[model samples]
Target: MMRTSLDQGTSDVSDQQGGVRTRTRAAIDAPHLRTDRWWLAPAATAAGLLAFIVYSTWRAFANADYYAAPYVSPFYSPCLAENCDAMRAGPNWDLFGGWWGISPAIIILIFPLGFRLTCYYYRKAYYRGFWASPPACAVAEPHKKYTGETRFPLVLQNIHRYFFYAAIVVAGILTYDTVLAFRDEHYEWGHMGLGTLVFLVNIVLIWAYTISCHSCRHIVGGKLKHFSRHPVRYRMWQWVGKLNARHMLLAWASLVSVALADFYVYLVASGAFDDPRLF
Candidate 1:
């Protein structure tokens, strides 16, 4: 038998029992042995997520400049209150009467926000970025052990499937809003503007991100003994699987798209500039 021991900067291998058995030495004491810059990724993720949270929170509470003619901010889409008339994208939903005085965006942002917050990729991103739980591969976490999602706060992640349902509805509403964006300020058909293009691209990315979700993929085709028996679902599952491969990309792209789309609406609604008609 061969026994191996590793010290601060040395390694010793000795024959113990004159057998073929070998014991491998490990650097268990060091936090991490990585020589490269492993902190950069987590730092960048924290910065990006923090920046987006601050910007979105400010915009959500602004309660103004969220609507510009047919263009509506994604954060404030499906505006469902009487106060939405001033910033109405489509016909006022009037779901909540005059009683709800707060920003209408506050009422509807929870679903989409919940979906993103509970996302698997986002869990990994924030866990590594903010919590520093084994920040990178081969790095040891500061905590002694993990309870995982079995706890109170972490257990909420299980509701991601429900959030996926709400996200689908939100995506549908945004699709309707995008369709409305085809009209001009006068609400006439056959019109296109720079904002129209922006909305179009943003909605496309949103749908791509939403549809590529893990829940959506599972719902499309998860538990089945045979794929051949259900051809349609199998085909859909194949498509979703391919999209799922790019879920992270779609997630970030949609995040930026929604923010930029809202900013464009803000610029136009604030009267900073007119939406240049492409027609």
Candidate 2:
């Protein structure tokens, strides 16, 4: 119970159920009383995310050094233009024709980018890192009023479910790319190199991140009234739930792995160094 006195600028607060103890709270007008540095997490998050954005945007536009004989950058996988003659990873997926002169990665990256942009985790991350909406706990946001995702650009987050479907297709393509990475520079099967190991790790992290998505969890587990009736879905849902718990960790791991994988291919394709054969 709180009894406020306008004249005294204090409140008589009962600290116990039976009013056995009473304490007065003299209001402090400061925004928050936190004494420690609370901005470090958001600052680091902004730095990491911003660094990735700069690197990815630059690489997406570069368009060169994204493919070597048997390895292709994840950014340019499923390259879909006639110009992708040497760069093409799998079968001739010249879906976009030769008229498209820009980077093939431009066509391929949109789906996965969309999936991550609208991801529930990324949204929360950028919301604090970039926007600083109440940046940390007990902190007051700068805005005078709060208008959530009810408006224009933010409202587009509702399409996350659609992006989830596109991500599944992209993951499948990357998986195919990872399989191709097992070959040597001469395209011989049963060969493994450092690049092959990189590709394998990248693909595993990507799948882990995708399968651990909240949308995946809902798709496999939600909308079921009786778990006893559907044994298969129940089992799958249990599996997804386990991964979902580590979704954030997987998200960061996959993000770094993809960039590193692409960088490795770039180094090899650019003739900076040959992908060292491991086996």
Candidate 3:
């Protein structure tokens, strides 16, 4: 009986040690799982954004209205001239295709997709927005350190200074286009082109995006200086910092507005929508 009792006690001790080992392993592995879950929100947001883009593009292509019919629609009235019926009668309605051998409409359509997928603000937003895999979530597993992707190309997004210059130029060109939209075939300002409104909105959206960028804020503020040494500089930085707070909001809205602007222009060029003139 004594021998049996000793053996039983030994077995119980071994079982307890095994249970402790199992628990230790589990505790080590739990963090990795939590870190992974943090990524779910951003991934979901990206998927949804992609879906809308695809649907909108497909709709733009499939619609028969994309090919302007007999009469210029009410939407084009801003540029319509006396006896302007001749411009709308033809089969060729694609302004971008006519101006550039490559369709500007298609270029505008695809530009945002590339920018958004690689945008710094978007990366941060996704990192924080996702519940399972937030940006700061680190794996607890020592052996399984999450050395996934280096944010090199992403960090290069700091080149928004260069992009700001480009955006300014583009905005100017768009503004010019807006002016052109008011001119009839006779080259006089008549009414309003729906395309003009769309183009103007696009300019505003791009401005919002460029201005709200973190890099732009830094450039404007002049990086990290002590307020005592440079109060004016510090104040400027503070103001920009305030705007930067809404950078994500500006980014997403800019993305949407630019896309819609292109879509509206495409519709007008395709003849899906009419621009009627009242004046």
Considering every candidate listed, which one attains the maximal TM-score?
1
Off by over 4 Å in 2: 1-27, 85-92
Model 2 per-residue lDDT tens digits across residues 1-279? 976645533334542212112143334334455778998988988899999999999999898898887888889878888777474346348899989998888998999999999988888888888887768887656665567899988999989888899989888988888888778888888899999899899999999999998888888876688889999999999999999899879989999999999999899989999888987
> What alpha-carbon RMSD in Å does predicted model 2 have with respect to the real structure?
6.4
Q: What are the per-residue Cα lDDT tens digits for candidate 1 across 1-279? A: 865665543433442211112235441445567889999999999999999999999999998998888788888888888888454348358899899998999899999999999998899999999998869987767775688889999999999999999999999988888888889998888899999899899999999999999888888996667899999999999999999999989999999999999999999999998999998
Clashes of 3: 25
Give me the displacement of residue 38 in model 2, in angstroms: 1.5
Per-residue CA lDDT of model 3 for 124-163, tens digit only, reads 6554444223434453223323333456654666554665
Indicate the worst ten consecutive residues by lDDT in candidate 2.
15-24
Clashes by residue pair, model 2: none
TM for every model, in the order presented, reads 0.89, 0.88, 0.57
What C-alpha lDDT values do all the predictions have?
A: 0.86, 0.83, 0.50
Query: What's the lDDT for candidate 3?
Result: 0.50
Error of 1 at 114 (Å): 0.6
Off by over 4 Å in 3: 1-40, 52-118, 125-160, 184-186, 224-236
Judge candidate 1 at residue 225 and give its lDDT. 70
